[model samples]
Target: MLPDQSYHIYNHANGSENIFREEENYRFFLHQYEKYLSAVVDTYAFCLMPNHFHLLVGVKEEAELARTFPKFETLEKLVSKQFSNFFSSYTQSFNKVYTRKGSLFIKNFKRKPILTECQWQDTFLYIHLNPIKHGFVKDLRNWKWSSFHGYESAKNPSKLERSYYLNYFDSWQHANYLMNIKKEAIMKEEME
Candidate 1:
């Protein structure tokens, strides 16, 4: 959650239940995420699945955050609070709509800080490949819930920092390499 750092953040549902019950659920969750976290983090890539989600984000620089929040000394607290609010808002609405109760997600989410180029790339491809590994789709092209669609956009004109991450490779074809990966081996290279 620290500023100026990249993290592979992920969390699963409370148990066997699914976090995203419908297509609108995924869209609503992303809208909430962008509303609360955009100011504090630069989103790179993300994958929203049925029961869980993965996000690759880099915390904004201190100066950037300072402009968003006057009280800069408590930058960490503000950033953390934004995430807490985002989660709570989504859960509240979900419960109201589904007529359910209790926490929707597990108690604590997992965030692995990215300190190296290799880890960042690994995390990016790992996230983009999640749907395929989980049996949602045989091809990444067929999955509509992931940020991969953003990358495939005509100008990459989405909230996702697609161009920045793609810059790591030689060209867009390099990103196509994700499709070349075997399904069984992808989940094995866990982010941690």
Candidate 2:
């Protein structure tokens, strides 16, 4: 998670467990994520499914982080620590509420850098369409736990870095057009 780099971060629940059992659970998880990650990264997109979650984020520039945490020796270390704390805090609260114990998430979550325009577009559609791919919904917009709604609505300017990514498409209309094309292609593949 280097500064100014876009990474696709993902993690799954341990075994066959559901990370979120109710709507409130999703809200709580997002709250914790914002509490820990907002200052360190600019959230581009996200999707929270029953057993897993995905986040497209750009790590804040070194200068931005330095201004926020003047004493931090390295931005990478600080960002990593924040992520660790985010998971631990969420897991602890979840355990206490559910009357269960042990790790809720798979050890050492995975992340891949978004190094190209194609990867960026693919990752965005991949995350938004996860519910459909998993048979949880028939349409991407039907899922309430993803940032798809934010992108489509063009609201919540503060939460998602929508403008930054939409710029890649030149306009919201173009972005939606591409999303539909991708969705159709995926659905066509599935039907084959």
Best by lDDT: 2
Per-residue CA lDDT of model 2 for 27-77, tens digit only, reads 999999999999999998899999999999999998999999999888889
Report RMSD for candidate 1. Answer: 3.4
Best by TM-score: 2
Off by over 4 Å in 1: 154-156, 182-192
Q: Can you write out model 1's per-residue Cα lDDT over 124-157, one digit (the tens) per residue?
A: 8889888978878877889999998888773847
**Residue 54 error for model 1, in Å?**
0.3
RMSD of 2: 1.3
lDDT for 17 (candidate 2): 99
* Clash total of candidate 2: 0
